[model samples]
Target: MSPSGNQDSAPEGVRLQKVLAAAGVASRRVCEQLIVEGRIRVNGAVVTELGTRIDPESDLVDVDGVAVQLDGTKRYIILNKPRGIVSTMKDEQGRPDLRRYTREWPERLFNVGRLDADTSGLLVLTNDGDLAHVLSHPSFGVTKVYIAKVEGRVSAQTIARLTAGVTLEDGPIAADKARLLSASGEGAGSLVELTLHSGRNRIVRRMMAEVGHPVVELVRRQFGPLHLGTLPVGKARELTKLERGALLTLSRRDAGDDRSAGDELSAGPRSQ
Candidate 1:
């Protein structure tokens, strides 16, 4: 269908390939290949044409004889989240939050994981549930990198203790890697970078506090293959094609699919 919402003037629904891709079957290019290969069916009939369109809200879309759900638009966005704004979609106190940044977005979006109101930096907001789950799942071992400013002179002992392990209220936690970004001569306040796979609540803060170098400021530098880059504070943008493709590939790998990259990307829709 055309970008305009005139159903009668143009087509009644979105293209078959777009429908499949938006349904999390695969990327648009791969979804087209699936259609050409006769793997996609609509209302029990094989659809091989790339120009086919159907109302996802009403039409029955099937892949390999199994129906696919096209309930809502799928969006994947990156935000250079600002401090003091909660990572959640909503706040009970009606204070600043992610919703304020995504208020113009049509689809209801949620953060892939929590980032405390006191923290800032790279945060992912998405309506795609499968990718979100795989990205945040601890078993996947996706690394979250952070750059933190701490109060006190950072010592080699501090780095060792952070990397070795520090017991928090929840359990024993350890950084996969930690290094001081500033020289010791910089004095009491120092900048440090940390890498870890844990997603526990307020973990970075707790770990730093326990190590005797309480965090004065914290910012996430990276999440998996994505980075904060030059995105201004409180601004967000849709993930680029390349970034989206790479993330989908990582999610497939995490799900234990051993198919070749090409085949895996052309794979069918996931069940809700």
Candidate 2:
């Protein structure tokens, strides 16, 4: 009578195959193959037993020669980017990139959007692919706010033109909101704040230059539900639980509004 108990149930701890799968290493079936091939090791010992259970918290897991942790600690980070550093992971001309700042991070992370090397401000980096996909998609319409210091004084007509639309080499683009922050002075540039949702390359600089007020400096202050705050330049930190929850909610909401039956968010880098 099998002791009159739940005979077909899983035992304590999670299956080794499941742990590997949950870590985004491979599928369950593939993980099983990895286990059978003696590629998986737990606590420095090769594990080949089928249905083997182990505690993820205490046990050290490694796949092949690389250590892997499936603890579901998805990293959501906000970096206060500084000028003269690229936003990408690698650079061809031996220039500084985001990798320089995130060398200590264990998990593989990607930047959500781009900030030009010449610009500075808030930037989001994460390993959560689904949330990144949703946030980066053009359809989500995530808002971005920037403060710009231009070479010369800006005019009401220029603001109106920017509010209306500006013709560029690519096409036409306009700011959702554009307002002056400070007046012009003797050889001092004017300060302006602009808000928009476009991800076009160098859009802000291009628009300002088109109106004869080339951007001397630019800083992104906000993006979607995240803010730059008082974080120092060239520093990175993990997102708080409340911020992560709110961002996840925003991403899910944007995804839910899709009309297509089988549409999936594209996981690609968005420009700012």
Candidate 3:
């Protein structure tokens, strides 16, 4: 039965959690939780043990009995998300989600981070889990540039308060950069650009609100080396090769190097 057979016969095996993650069923952490819950089955038998391996090509691996497929290609996309669309892939209330904005995108990519349903601008989507994880982590110190319209005139004192740091319900929060775009009138608001290294929930709004100038409108204009310059609202484009490389370099620098805490201090945004 074995006569000079050279064709490959080895079954390609991968960790059960990785298989579930690659299938977009859930994140690795959530997949581990699912495994602990005995919801994953391999070859018709429920398997709950962590680090369990399965052959993707031969074994009938399923999550809750639904068969899943492995993801072979890594996808990355830059989406110019418009207002009102939720950044998440799915909404439990059956509300319109980011998937609608990405219907034309070829691959099924998840957002790298998130912009609030009300917030809008450049959002990065990708199937590369590692990059997504790295980009979202605070250790990467990916600076996000946001242009905000505030309810009142942004004075030097307000900018000083932001740069000095303000205490929030969660903890003390500070802006890495803050500057007034222009002061309109006595009651009219001013446009300001604020940058921050941390991605706390609704941080810009909360910070400005704390300073007596609540954000009336907010738009994220940049992340790291990526900028939203001249890109019309609701229209997205792919990242340039150089931009991708620069982001990767920043990620590496942030991950492996340890600099003084003061080194992370960002300058206040200049008036433009």
Candidate 4:
């Protein structure tokens, strides 16, 4: 039997799936399945719950009876993801993943959220599960800023309709902020900046389509306090301390200050 530590070591913490992923066993979704199948043991006892938490260093975790080392350092990476690479840890169709983009890094990491394989720019990767969950959750309202080039002119009426709200097949969708970055003519295509709080699948594309202006190209320039800056496509850089702290504060505010929930919420973008 693996030796156990004081209960103090088991303070409420990151999800079990995230911890397992950071330990380099597999992705979070796979780890959740493993937990459900009773293939994981914490301190020698099988644990099947998805939300179980334990201290990384003090807890003894064994996957399929093999001890797993907990990662000691939190990792945050910013990747200028080029189109074609999937924003996932693994792909069933055998497509290239973000791992290929960060192959040179010593520590393993996972993406904060997914970007469609066809659309890409400024994808964040990290080994910190808490940060990932906080950043990805809709309730957190982390503002995502994107630049889109559409097929035809986006009229002032279309802009008003977008700002007001539009109903999609999925539901009603609205932009927190939108402005014409540049335009050619009333009938010519233009560039626009869209800031949104929701991270729905293909949201930018769908929103533009709803407004009768299908996107010709899309690029995400910012997420929360982080920016793509001048990072070249397919390249990655480590996040600065100030950036991480600001993200943490934003997450805290988003999590609604329920210290027990361990996630925070922030006042996100106000519609303008």
Candidate 5:
């Protein structure tokens, strides 16, 4: 038996194929095929042996270079946050906070990133600190898309300026994409969608104001691979298998595209 494989008929841990199936990677047969083709890695080492066993709670597993979450205690939640709720778990100021969304879950979940009290949309709550760090860290370049209702008509020239880039009091910034969804006839308001990788404080609002359109309201519609997708305001749901895989894959690619998941989490802070 390989050192990473079972020592005897009574294996120490669960079968590698069984674990992958349980995590919804594939059916048992397909998982075994993947292992045979050298596509699966356990604890950063490729294991082709059929009887390999891994501690689901502690072992690191990846399928075709994408991280696979095996630990059941780690909770991942998607919340369609409503306005007036703070992003924090517990507020020192005693204001409305995120605790209500996480109170039912036994695990101590916290928001991955942040949204201001007045701005509301998709917010992730999770107990996985490494996942949170990977998602929120500015240097990872995970893009966020926002829909803003701003004052006055947004002209094409303004849109051009936004996409080309704009300079704020603090520094220069640009939208990865900027377009006017709709503009009211009598300056009622305009809906503009912008995609950017910035996590700067009130960045969208500041950018609009600098471009001569002050924002009346803002809503984040998407973050990285996750979308808000009709999830009702103030409601939360657990991540589906596909969603989890997509996120882990993105995190894996972001961490220099070669290191193990554990190694990426253990490394020092990324350069800004």
Candidate 6:
């Protein structure tokens, strides 16, 4: 949608640079330079006019190629979930759930997908329903990276088996990538990382167990384009500008698949 809703022949909206700065794209002065250099796009059109105005409420903006969220009212959160916290907003069994983390935000934010009670790591919380669905649904090719501490030492053969695919009780599933991180000895515990796009219930644990090594503990380190960097456990924070851009880009890319089926985004290689 091009800039619109002129009031008495005037642009009647916020200045482009100001809107860009407000979106955390850059400082106001730098945003002006970006406008001059034509590094910005509004509604899929390159916008370089210094006097250009836009409706932040309706205009779709992007920096370089990444989509920028113009709505400040929406919340996109990254939570480093700790073990033993159920993924739901409320738990019927009275177990610890995600309600506490969401209580502080005024907007009703729900987790994009889930990390079971015993497993924890990065969980995205957002009020953007469209983007949430794109990130959560496995059909869109959104991948998740999990690091598992298993009961027995993992070997190259086991890693190959994971990538080669395994037959679970539900059906056949394969890891997008698998690697053995560490193994102390022949009988000691092992650290293995597996990347997968499947959303089957407790899939990581079930896959490891199917290979004769049950998961002792598991943590998701990556989800699609986002990663669980050094964020402390059980804490929630707003996504950084770059992080937010990458996530939104992934969502938009997947959303495009409907118009151009068979042109899905690559889930990357078979290694973590």
Deviation in Å, model 3, residue 89 alpha carbon = 1.1
Which residues of candidate 1, in runs, are more than 4 Å off?
Answer: 1-72, 184-188, 258-272
Off by over 4 Å in 4: 1-72, 185-188, 256-272
lDDT of 6: 0.84
TM-score for all predictions?
0.69, 0.68, 0.66, 0.67, 0.86, 0.88
Give me the candidate number with maximum lDDT: 5
Worst 10 residues of 2 by lDDT: 263-272
In model 3, what is the error at residue 139, expressed in angstroms? Answer: 2.9
Give one digit per residue, the lDDT tens place, for model 6 in 87-185: 988889999999899888899989998998888899999999989999988899899999999987788999999999999989999999999989876
Query: Which portions of model 6 miss their true places by more than 4 Å?
Result: 2-8, 257-272
Better of 1 and 2 by TM-score: 1
Cα displacement (Å) at residue 97, model 1: 1.5
For residues 18-98, what per-residue lDDT tens digits would candidate 1 score against the true structure? 888987889999999999899986654567888777767655566654446566567889998898997777789998878
| TM-score winner between candidates 4 and 6 | 6
Note the Cα lDDT for every prediction shown: 0.79, 0.78, 0.73, 0.76, 0.85, 0.84
Estimate the lDDT of model 3: 0.73
Judge candidate 1 at residue 201 and give its lDDT. 82
Give the top-scoring candidate (TM-score). 6
Better of 2 and 6 by TM-score: 6
Superposition TM-score, candidate 3 onto the true structure: 0.66
Question: In model 6, how large is the Cα lDDT of residue 22?
Answer: 86
- Model 2 lDDT per residue over 1-272, tens place: 01112546545567888888887778999999998899976655677876677676655566754556445767888998999989888888889889976777898899998999999999999887767888877677998999999988788888889889999999999999999888677379899899988989999999999998999899999989888888998889887645665675576557653122223213111111
Instruction: Give the per-residue lDDT of model 5 (tens digit) for 1-272.
Output: 12323434454667889889998889999999999999987656677877777678766678877779887788989999999999999899999999989878999899999999999999999988877888999899899999999999999999999999999988899999998899986469899999999889999999999998999999999989999998999999998877887787787667654454465344211111
Count of clashing residue pairs in every prediction: 0, 0, 0, 11, 0, 0
lDDT of 3 by residue, 1-272 (tens): 01112336432346778877876778999999998899975544566788576655444455654445443465556777888888899999887687776677677788888998889888988776666777888777789999998887788888888889999999998899888889887578899899998978999989989998888889999988788878887776666645554554455455642222243224211111
